[model samples]
Target: MIEVKEIEKKYGRKKILKGVSFTANKGEITCLIGLNGVGKTTILNAIMALTPINKGQILIDGEPLKEKTFEKITFIPDAITMLPQMKIAEAMEFMKDFYTCWNQDRATELLGFFRLNKDDRISSLSKGNTAKVNLLLGLALDVDYVLMDEPFSGIDMFSREEIANVFTSHLIENRGVIITTHEIGDIEHLIDKVVLIDNGLVTKEFNAEEARENEGKSVIDVMREVYIG
Candidate 1:
């Protein structure tokens, strides 16, 4: 489980995140949703320690996240820079050496699912395929927490569906996934909880089952009301 308590961050005079608090429990997928620039990515960065917060604590399983927590967390951002000169197979081999949790069989299966050729140069793959590889790497890492920022940003509909399904089925049930995405439809069925941020604050949090039972609305409908209404 991951608990973010009263996180606050600022860039000059503009406050990006203010007193944010949320929990992502194991065996559940919690989605962060909101309009662009509403601090969704900032929250993920803060949790990953990629961006230092001015205030508050980020805890993993009741313990505050420190430098040693890197092994427990895997982050996949919207834009990732790989050695564009390397081949797909070479990149996988490099990551396997770097992370103790790297799963070779899972990586191979993901490559096949995405129709990615191992010998293809990283720079030669299309934009969507590039994102697929990024996603593949994160999913294959055996970690407790996976934070994905805009994982569905540029993919086609069919690939997006396939990716979502694979993520759901392959994810370790004992771990947690916190994903930030504008494409709510892609994860509507997969997510267990929704945490919507707006104006730099957590404006909404709902469980899929509770929301459906109490509000009689789908996740897409709730999202429209939260960010668009």
Candidate 2:
């Protein structure tokens, strides 16, 4: 499991995360849901160690995050990370050289699943295609945990549907996932847990099935109570 304890982060003097805490268990999809600019992405960044935190710690299976630990956890950021000048095939090679966990067969499978051509230049792909490429890069890694930031943001309907389908496929089975997004409807049925955040604070955490079976509330209903009520 990934454990985040009292995580605090700041930019200059402005604080972003204020004592945030949560756990993403293995074999489940844990979602961080909140409005824009509420430090959802910041939390994911802190987990990946892409951003420095002022106080607190993140642990994977009771161990502090390190270079070797990254092999087990993969993060897909909100924006494209690859150089636009590179072709899809070159991007694959770049990942191959960097991470020992890169799986070429999985990459090839995702390329077919996303209908992406290796000859296509990253700069020439549509917004949705670029998103697919980003997803492919992460999904191809043979990791236990996958952290994603807004994988469904600013894409077309078909692309959104396709990406959602991937969540239910065997590709992600048995792997833990932490995804931060305001677009919860797409994966509401697929998520196992929900962590609601607001104004840099983690307000609630609960099992999705329990919320429905015991309380008769869906994720949207819980979101309304946290963000609206």
Candidate 3:
């Protein structure tokens, strides 16, 4: 479980996150939704330790996130710009050596499942294929928390659907997954929990099943009201 307590962030005099608090439980997929410039990415960055929080704390599995806890978590950004000249196989091997939880079989399975040729160069693949590679690497890591920032940014609808399916199958059971994306339509069914952020603050958190039953609404509908209503 990851617990974020009263987190705050500011760039110079402008505050980006305002005392946000939430607990992302194990066995749940937590999706963060918000309008552009609402500091959704900032929250992920703070959790990943790429940006320091001005206040509050983030604890992973009851312990604060530190350099030593890196093996327990994995963060995949929207786009990864690895060496363009490297082969797909080469990149996988490099990641295998770096991350302790790297599973070679899992990587190869995803490669085959995605129909990506290992001999192909990263520079030659299409944008959506590149995103598949990024997703595969993160999944193979087998971390407790997989933080994805707009993993479906540039993919087409078909590819996005495929990627979403991969997410459903690869999620480590009893582990937490946090994804930040504007295209909530592709992932409504997969997400177990929703955290709505606006103007750097968490405005709402709802369980998917509960919302559907009690509110008779979809995640996107609730999001429209949360961000606009």
Candidate 4:
């Protein structure tokens, strides 16, 4: 399990995350949902230790992040980190060299799943395909947990559909997943938990299926209450 306890982040005098707390268990899809500029990405960064927190603690499977614990997780940012000149195959090779957890078989499977060509240069792909490559690289890692920052943003609907399908696939089974998104209409059915944020604070955190089964409300219905009221 990944636990974030009373975490806070600040930029200059402005606080971005104000005592945010949440827990994401393995084998469940946990989503951090909020409008843009509301510190959703910052929370993901804090979990990855990519950004420093002002106060509070983050524990991965009960231990703090360090050189050894770092290997247990992976973060896939909104944008691809590879050079445009690099081919898809080359980018996979780059990951292979950098992380011991890189799995070539999974990478190969994802390449085929996304219908992407390994020989194509990163600069030549469309926005949807580019997003696919970015996702492919991260999901290829055999880490225990995966944190994604807006995997469905700014892409074609078909591409978004394809990417969303990966969530239901066995590719992510039995692993902890923390994904951030402002849009949850397409993925509400795919997530186990939703942590709602507003003004850097967690407004609500509830099980998506439970919300429906018990309250007869969709995730968006609850969002309307939080963001509108």
Which candidate ranks first by TM-score, i.e. highest? 2
Candidate 1, position 24, lDDT: 96
lDDT of 1 by residue, 116-177 (tens): 99998889988788888888778778888889998888778777776777666755466789
Cα error, candidate 2, residue 86 (Å)? 0.6
Selected candidate, larger lDDT, 1 vs 4: 4
What's model 4's overall lDDT?
0.93
Model 2 regions more than 4 Å off: none
**TM-score of each predicted structure versus truth:** 0.93, 0.97, 0.93, 0.97
lDDT by residue for model 2 (1-229), tens? 9999999988888888899999999889999998899999999989988888999999998998999987899999977889999999999999999999999999999999999999999999999999999999999999999999998999999999999988999779999999998868878899999999988899999999999999999999988887777
* RMSD vs true structure, all candidates: 1.8, 0.9, 1.6, 1.1
Question: Which segments of candidate 1 are over 4 A away from where they belong?
Answer: 224-229
Instruction: Please rank every candidate by TM-score, starting with the best.
Output: 2, 4, 3, 1
Number of clashes recorded per candidate: 0, 0, 0, 0
Q: Candidate 3 — which residues are off by over 4 angstroms?
A: 170-172
lDDT of candidate 2?
A: 0.93
Candidate with the greatest lDDT versus the true structure: 4
Local error of candidate 2 at residue 123 (angstroms): 0.5
Clashing pairs in 2: none
